[model samples]
Every structure is written in structure tokens, then in C-alpha cells.
Target: MNIGFIGLGIMGSGMANNLLKSGFNMYVFNRTREKAKELEDNGAKFCSTPKELAEKSDLIFMMLTDVRACRAVSEDKDGFLESLSKGKVVVNFSTVHPNYSLELREMVKEKEAMFLESPVLGSKIPAQKGELVILSAGDKEAFEICTDAFEKISKKAMYLGDVPKASYVKVVNNEAFATSLTAYLEGLAFAKKIGLDPEMVFNILNSGALSNPYFEFKVKKVLNDDFETHFSFENMKKDLGYALSVADEFKCYCPTLAAVNEIFKKGLNKHAKEDMSAVYKIFDE
Candidate 1:
């Protein structure tokens, strides 16, 4: 497959590396052109514009930050829409609004192209290991054709039926993740202030039914005070906002997520560029 990828941030960079290692010829672009330099050095062709990349590839993957970026990439003068061709597939791995995905789907279809919503369920480490979980939706044929690529990028790629369904699933999944992580971190924060060893708190709960591997991995980072950026607080806040939008559209009660969103906002206020784990600082802040 002649493949292209735009956006080379934390998650995107590793995903691009996996695609390159999969032996596909890659066309690449990023607003911060320097971000693509590493991949360009690795034999990926670098393009100046999304349209240029779109024109030259049969498949393009977008791992952008928000709905605005996603829309701009598609509709801007030198964007994806300008060069979209029939039968070409564009797979978006960005966590954005489902309604925006639906609108983009229609725009892509108008050009006889297919748009696949493929929001991922892991951050930098998982992307580096090609172990992210992919929730995909859109044209079944496009999904099938991209299965091999998805295999190279994720541990599992599940096809959910249509454009917005995958987006909806992604937001729901992320909202739950934020809520769960917030509650866990709150416990750790409480343990610290109350003179209990936070590590013991993590160790005890982590040994029980509610345990998850990520809980252990993240606790190590927290204990070490290593708040490097795998997934930034900025991006987490963006996804949290998108998830809340989904909740509102469905008229679903989401007090937990609503409160969680504010917590992430506060985290971003001070440590905007740091990893989401920096939200732990919320206790001290």
C-alpha cells in the first residue's frame, strides 16, 4: 500500500515508525516539518502539504489533536480534500467529536473517497510497541483493505459498522478511562496527605480485581516523579471535552466525567505540556 501519515506528535511518531517498519512506502507531512525529519531520514517521503501527500498515496492516516485540526486538514486550500481521489481511503486516528467525524465522512464520500474513524486506545508506549487497540468504522471494504496496516499498528483493530460509531465508542472509552484514572489518582493523593505510603495503596488495590497493568506502570512514574510527556494534559483535556460533547448529545448523565474534565483542565493549566500523569500535581496545586 502507498501510505501517508500526517501529525507526528507523541502517539503519531511511533505509529509512523511502525508503518515504516512494516515495509510500506510512506508519504509524510506535519505542520512542524522538523517532526517528520526522523521518519524522512528513514526513507519516508516528506510532503509540503496534506494535499500533496493525499495525491500521492492510496491510504492516509491522520493522528491529529482535535476536531479543528482534522477539519483544517481536510478543507484547507492545500488540504486532503483538494486531492482526494475515488477509492482512496483516509483513516483518522484522532480523538475528536463524533459529529465532526460524521461531517468529514460525508465530505470524503462526496469526493468518492472513504473515511474511516479509527481512534486508538493506548498512548506512546503502546504505539511504540504496535500494541494500541484500534476501534475502526466506515466502509467495510476500506476496513478490510487496511487490516494488514492496522495489524502493524495495533494489537487489535475492531470494525464497528459506520463512521460515527467508532468515534462514539472512542469517546465513551476515553471518558470511562478518565473517570477511572481520576478516581484512582484521587485515592493515591488522599493516601499521600493522610500519611499512608501511596505505593502501598497502589500495591494493595492493584493486587485485587480492579487492577490493570497501566495502573502499575503509571504508579511507577508517579512515585519517581517522572512526568514526561507520553500523552499530554492538553490532548487529554481535548478528548475529555469531546467525550462530554458526546454525553450531551445523547442526553446522558455524566457528573463524574464533567468533574473529571475540570480536573484535567486544572492539570493543563500548570503542566499543560507534561504527561497526563502530572494531574497528580492537582493535589499539591
Candidate 2:
């Protein structure tokens, strides 16, 4: 299959590499051309722009960071919408608002193109091993056609039946993850504040019922105070914002999500340029 990928950040880069390793013909584009150079060395062709990438590929996978960037690339002048032909599929792998995904679905269908919202669940390490889960929704025919490529980059591709539903599921998953991470942070922080040895507290958490792999992995970064931006604080803030919007739209009373959204904002305000793991600092208060 001719696969075109845009965005070359931590997760996107790993996913694209997996596609190349799986022997797909990969065409990659990044706003920053230097980012595409690494993939070029791996036999993935590089494109100067999204329009160029769209013209040459049957499927275009977008792993951009935000709704604004996704919209710009897919809807702008001479954009993917302009260049995409009938029967092509645009697979979105970014975490975006459901409403935006719905709009994009319509946008692509207008061009006789198919839109698949396939926001992934799992970060850098999982993506590297091709163990990331893809939650997707779109036209059934398009979904079937793209399943092979999806399987190449993911441990599983779950079809959620339609566009907005998959996006809703992704937002809820992020909300739950944020909620659990916050509670985990609070427990660990309180243990330290009460005169317990920090290392022992962490060791116990890592060894006990609360010892999830996420805690095992992220606690080290939290303890070492290394907030390098694998995923930025601003990104978490955006995710929380979108999740809360979904809750509000459905008249769902999600106090925990609401609280986490506030805490995410505070973390972003304090560490606007830091990694999302810095959300722990708010719990430290």
C-alpha cells in the first residue's frame, strides 16, 4: 500500500517507522523538513507539502498535535481536500474534538474521499513496538480497506462504527487516564509530605496493588524532576478541555473530569513549556 504520513513527533515518528519496517511504501511529510530526513534515510520518500503527499498516496495518515493544525492541513488552500481523489482515505491519528472529527468526515466525503478518525491509545514506547491500539470509526468500506495498514502500525484496530464515537471514546479514555494519574500523584505526594522516605514510598507503590506499569514508568520521571516534553503540558490541557466539552455536550456530570481539567490548567500555567508529567506538581500542592 502507498502510505503517506504527516507529523514526525515522538509518537508519529515511531508509528511511521513501524509502517516502513512492515514493508509499506511510506511517503512522509513534516512542516519542518529536517524531521523528514530521518525517515528519508529509512527509504521513506519525503514530500515538501501535504498537497504533494496527497497526490501520490492512496492513504494519508495524519498524526498532528492539535485540531487547528489538523484542520489547516486538511482544509486549507491546495490542501489535502483539494488534492485528494475519489477512493482515497484520510486517517486521522491525532486526538481531536469529536465535533471537529465530524466536520472533517463531512469534508472528506464531499470530495468523494473517505475519512477515518483513528486516534491512538499509547505513547512513545508502545508506538515503537507497534503495540498501540487504534480506535477508529468511518465508512465501513473504507475501514475494511485500511485495516491492513492499521494492523501494520497497531496491536489492534477497533472499529467504533462511526467518526464521532471513536473520538468520544478517545476523549473519555484520556479523561480516565488523567483522573487516575492525578489520584496516584496525590497519594505519592502525601506519602512524602508525611515524613516517609520518598524512595520507600515509591518502591512500595511500585510493588503493591497500586503498582501499575504507568506508575512504574512515570514515577521515575516525576521523582527525577525530568519534565522533558515527550508530551507537553499544553497538550494535556487541550485533551482535558476537549474531554470536558464532550461531557458538557452530553449533560454528563463528570466532577472528577472537571477537577482534572482545572488541575491540568494550573499545571499548564505553571509549566507551560514542560512535559505533561509535570501535572504531578499540582498534586504536590
The best candidate by lDDT is: 1
Q: Which pairs of residues have clashing backbones in candidate 2?
A: none
lDDT per residue (tens digit) for residues 75-145 in model 2: 78757777898999999999999999999999898889988999999888888899999998988888899
Candidate 2 Cα errors over 4 Å, as ranges: none
Each prediction's TM-score against the native? 0.97, 0.95
Clashing pairs in 1: none
| Candidate 1 lDDT by residue in tens digits, 1-285 | 899998998889999999999899999999999999899999999999999999999998999999888878889889988999999999999988888888889998999998899999999999999999999999999999899999998999999997789988888887887788778888899998999998888888889986998877877898889989888888888989998878888899999999999998877768889888788889744
